[model samples]
Target: MSNVLRIALVDPNDSTREMLKAMLLGMDTVWLEADCSRYEFFSDIIEQTAPDVGVVTLDSDEDRAIALVERLSKEAKDTVILAASESTDGHLILRTIRSGAREFLTLPVTKDDLAAALGRVSQQKFGTADGGGRSCEVIAIAGATGGVGTTSASVNLGCILASDSRNSVALLDLDLALGDADVFLDAIPDYTLADVVQNISRLDIQLLKQSLTKHSSGLYLLPRPVELHDTASITDESLRKVIGLLKASFSHLIIDLSKTYSPVDMAAIEAASRVILMTQLDLPCLRNVVRLMMSFEEIEGLQSKVEIVVNRAGLESGQISLKKAKETLGREVYALLPNDYRTMVEVRNNGVPLITQAPKAAITQAMRDLAAKLQGKSGGKVEAEPDKSAESKWKKFWPGAAKS
Candidate 1:
């Protein structure tokens, strides 16, 4: 009697499967349990053979391969799936990982590489892996309308969060077609969110990091697609999966959303720990904020997580005052960002975050304060007391407004 590892092989090529079986038979520590030409019977093979490991060949049929891996991972919980492919394309490797493969190997496999891969599987099975599970806080930022400084705020906030050495931050430009987050950081990423979504089935922490463009401030950005047509390929399910993976891998996840509330936008909102609703000190922006708040209130527990951010506060003389704005919206102002037009323009032109270029600027300090409040480092205070008299006025404007 000899100690052996039970293995199951699934390959469409007859000759390749036979060769692999012969190689495994030659190894005293390995036991060939089953061999097949297709993955459709993988469940039956797993039940009959009780394989400790399942090696499946991935060829031109990528969708079928991915589905097989996913099903095996879910159905045969005790068995680990190792995907093998002739092509060493990065996208293919990523898709394999996303499809729930425990490991990926290139074809014409060597015994040493095979042994190393199996070693890891054994370690994971015995619970000796370090930092096996971790979670991250996800924050979603949305503007009431265009030019409300939503992208600017998100970039600065992400930079500030990443400033902490212990924290890892990722900023996702969910606007898809019209995102400018990369421009704010002055980064021209080779890979965008479209690349990630297209290969979403293979997405893992390593693949995600590869797709992101890193900034000098240590923030990672997943930019929007360069072409508008690519946006159509991004589905709500894919967005959720990408966001879910980001949440698991980073310390902070920031999403900059377009003004329109598409299904994908709603999915991001649902995943967010807090939704920063950005607005300006203007009548139209204020009215839109009220309407958004009413909609959020309809969703269970969403209203409580919303924090109102008044961007470009005190910019113009005729703009709505923060005091009156709060009364009109029937909620406390979460934070006030100062208006610094010249500095903003310079920062935008330079494609650098305000925190990095002008660290001591008032606007930068305001951004820092907001970050601290979000991280629970400071208790965010309302600058002015709510006017009880204005409560009636808000009700008159919108009878459904919640009384403060």
Candidate 2:
């Protein structure tokens, strides 16, 4: 409870422990009072040292670590319990929090993450908010196929969200090979996802935030790597680790995903609170939407989180009707993005956001409504579905489709 806070830690891996120690040495307000390798012996060290904070690394043995946390929460009431792990899966974080950990840190232990955790303990024990981060809402935008305006929706929605002075939004261009989110905003970033993954050991919230390209609308952009080879090492776990850190700092994370539905996209989808499936009222897009929905049905709880959005709804005379599109998707379209070829093409070529270039355009209003829907506000009404008995080529095309 003094100016310098006392700390004790338990991590079995010598390398990871040393890395953590080096990180802690750089933090000026913290003092390493004692350290232990064994989970059972950690309690005794805390009892003897009387440290203000106790750090427990859970990757070595999760069961024992949770048990130790529960025990310390009751026995050593004065010390704040903090948990760490290489995995950011919700199950571990939830269980650790339930066992009475004050803050959960992801491993290799970013310095800012540690400082924020300890700062939270300081605030709770004495009233301060030095490094605490407000919680963030993550939204994943996926395309049914190419040219469906997935990136366009993502960038515009992000810009609209950032228009509010009270909000801070970050856009992640996960389209590794063909991403244009950076070009969309006309902001070139110094670093990309690959740089973050390669330098993960040295990354902290402060450093990572500084590396991103901040747009004039106050939106932070993390674009895809410049070279295709740079994306090879960006795996699901690494992407999750980066996302976990970003979630700690931003208010909103808009992930513009690659259309491949690879492991990387699955990881982002798994982490998102809202998933927008961008589709147009065309035969190919609709079929792909249903196919994707079938895949989602297999993934336990994924289907419920998705919202089917129809882009370029009134683009052409031959396109499918909104009523029939609903019957084809077997679900109501979340929102309709009107087709404004001149406005959109100009905005894209000029590298300006629709929200900025064409503020009064109908598509811009559609972006606002999309943001409102994500925020649980009243959105534009969806058209009601027509009769299932109506002879439909889509129903006949794909057997065992959803009931109309």
The number of the candidate with the highest lDDT is: 2
**Candidate 2: Cα lDDT at 144:** 90
Q: How much lDDT does each candidate structure score?
A: 0.82, 0.83
Tens-place lDDT per residue, model 2, 1-404, is 12445688899878888888888757755656667788989988888777778989999999999999999999999999989999999999999999999889988777877888888787776566552233467899999999999988988999988888767889999999989999888887899989998987666555777878999988899999999999998999999878876775577999999989999999999999788999988888888987887688778788878888889878777798988777666667878899888888888888899878989999899889889878767744455553446435445556665364
lDDT of 2: 0.83
- Cα deviation at 184, candidate 1, in Å, is 0.8
Q: Model 1: residues >4 Å from true position, as ranges?
A: 1-134, 380-395, 398-404
Q: What is the lDDT of candidate 1?
A: 0.82
Q: How well does candidate 1 match the true structure in TM-score terms?
A: 0.66
Cα deviation of 324, candidate 1, in Å:
1.4
